[model samples]
Target: MPGSLEPLDLGVQIPYHFRCPISLELMRDPVTVSTGQTYDRPSIESWVATGNTTCPVTRAPLSDFTLIPNHTLRRLIQDWCVANRSFGVERIPTPKQPADPTHIRHLLTQSASNSNPYPTRLSALRRLRGLARDLDKNRSTISSQNSREILVQLVFADTGSESSELTHEALALLVLFPLPESDCAAVASNPDRVAYLAQLVQHSSMEVRVNSAALIENVLAGSRTAELRAEISNVDEIHQGVVSILRNPIAYPRALKIGIKALFALCLVKQTRNKAVSAGAPETLINTLADFEKCDSERALATIELLCRVPDGCTAFAAHALTVPLLVKTILKISDRATEYAAGALLSLCSASEKSQNDAVAAGVLTQLLLLVQSDCTDRAKRKAQLLLKLLRDSWPEDSVGNSDDFVCSELVVPF
Candidate 1:
């Protein structure tokens, strides 16, 4: 038998001869023995089930080594297990500190002093950055209303005489802060706040414009108010600013990218549909389709993609100057893969028009599509051809059977 255990005079005493082999710390999962020998919980459990008759360390003869855990130790084990299982990992605890008004004031002051003022000292900048990171991580800690207010204040801070850098930072901060629906409601409720964002959409710097576009997207995602949607729709100066960028060949691609993103944002609002319709957004889109003919193949394809997204009702205008034949000829002329993709888009527009659809069928659009379908080309083009054929079959007149040679292909007939 092992000698009686000695009592050590240590300030802090831990139970068990061996630390928990699993955790490599204190004996968390504890088990008691018949001879009152205690072992790490997991070790004892394993031994009890295996019908071991003696202690591994003491080697004492054991008649009945009942494994019972200490209540306190069991609770700790349960809690640790739950936390591990629930979170799937342990999280490092962050120290709690009182809110520092001075830090907030300093950030605001710096923002006011420079158009793009960041912390001067490396330590301070790191700390500020850390705080921003913490705020992002613990966003649920603050109420939605408070978070939006703080974000709005940050957005409004004036950075000294340099407007560009400061504006960029402010916009960056706006994008970084994740606000809830309630917060968006609070920020958008205020006309002045919405107006401030509208102004940023027209800011001189492209960086600012890009950031503003992102902010608008975030705001519109949660917006429900018709009045707010109408206000945004009516911002002609901002729209013109965006349009001017799109019209400039040198800068248009970048600007059009932003404009398309912003338009997507506005489309999220149910009320903005009428506003877009009223603003002749359809006409603008049609114009883009026409402009595609003059642009590079890649750019033309992008323009076609954007044009397809124009509201469905806008196809009524296609019968006038934007005839189906013109679009088909344009598509047929280009040999690039992208131009082939644009041809698919043009087909969609042709289908959209009541008059154009009839004209397209008569003018051998189906024959051309069948040839493209059978050609050794991209899967995207082939898939588009399949879709066009399906749409044409569904739309074909009852008496229009056996009129076209292209429709008589073996593969097409099998499917039909």
Candidate 2:
């Protein structure tokens, strides 16, 4: 009943031709196939995309796949909607035609053409970006036209008088396109391109910086070889830029997630792990964890787990005043993945530092660890919880643990 199109109760008679044959809804962006019958663009595109070759209304075998826009019908629909405004009908907007490959190729050429004036080239770039953003078909068309290579050249090779402005525009478009792993690998393998990327991440503009961070995350995730990942991770400029992105109070949430994921990938390398720890990754994550939701909390906590592997990372975790309480508070509170990461981070800290163990105890980690052991957390998390329970109990005198019988009895039976 909810999806029914019978408007008889609304006191307005609707024309039969205004409705799509497939969906029985008012046709928006009507288009006709070779069979001379019209359908809504989305409905017909979906029908064709599913491998149906015949017209839905006429049921005739289709010869041409071209969908000609039925402008007359669309105009009539708009006029009818305007006249029926009191009946709650709204006018549908005119749809732009999808940019074909030939047009996309022309725009690509104009954007990269040296003979064109700076404004003309930039205008072409902006137009192409608009097309890319308009539809998935346009994005695929632009990508198929070798847009990535041109954009890469703009960001890395061009040093023209307006290179910076052009580079930012190209970078924005590049981020929109789905970059292949092979292309990303090729870019990451070059030291000069990597250096340029480092500078771009630290760009004066927030949009540029956010785009650069996203691009780096993509490249880091796609880099096939350890050597390539290490090559990018070891750069002080690159890792520091990523850390600074996390530090920015006004950085977009997407940018923060990208920065955290990128830092996590970089931390896969031993040297980069040290660099991230030194850059205050633990402290920054601790400060931000309060505001993060389940998934982001899991990611931030996981990075903190990776950081706690080294002695200095453990020290950094302890040095942050909120670190122990945050880790203790996170256990059994967020998702199970988050619980595991937080437990793992706390175990690392408690195992390394007596002061951290005492701090964890003071923060009431015993109650959290006891709850973790009883809950249905992961086996790995349970093991860490058990270890933390034993570690905390062993670190304190029997008299200091208080009269909490459940906390003391947790160590007697393994949750396993």
| Model 1 CA lDDT for position 187 | 56
Residue range 1-416, candidate 1, lDDT tens digits:
01111212222233344345334444544667776766665566677568877877678888685565555555564454344443332322222332254565465444444345254422332344455556532332322224345545567554233344434565555565555676567657766666677677677776676667667656666667766555565565544444444443345455555555566456445544544444444455545544433334345454444445465433533533554554455544566465465556655665676566676666566667666666665657666656666566745655654553354454533332
lDDT of 2 by residue, 219-335 (tens): 877788888888788778777788877876554766676777777778877767888877777788887777666776788888899899988888888899999998898888889
lDDT of 2 at 388: 79
**Global lDDT of each model?**
0.53, 0.81
Candidate with best lDDT: 2
Clashing pairs in 1: 29-41, 113-160, 114-159, 114-160, 115-159, 115-166, 116-166
Q: What is the lDDT of candidate 2?
A: 0.81
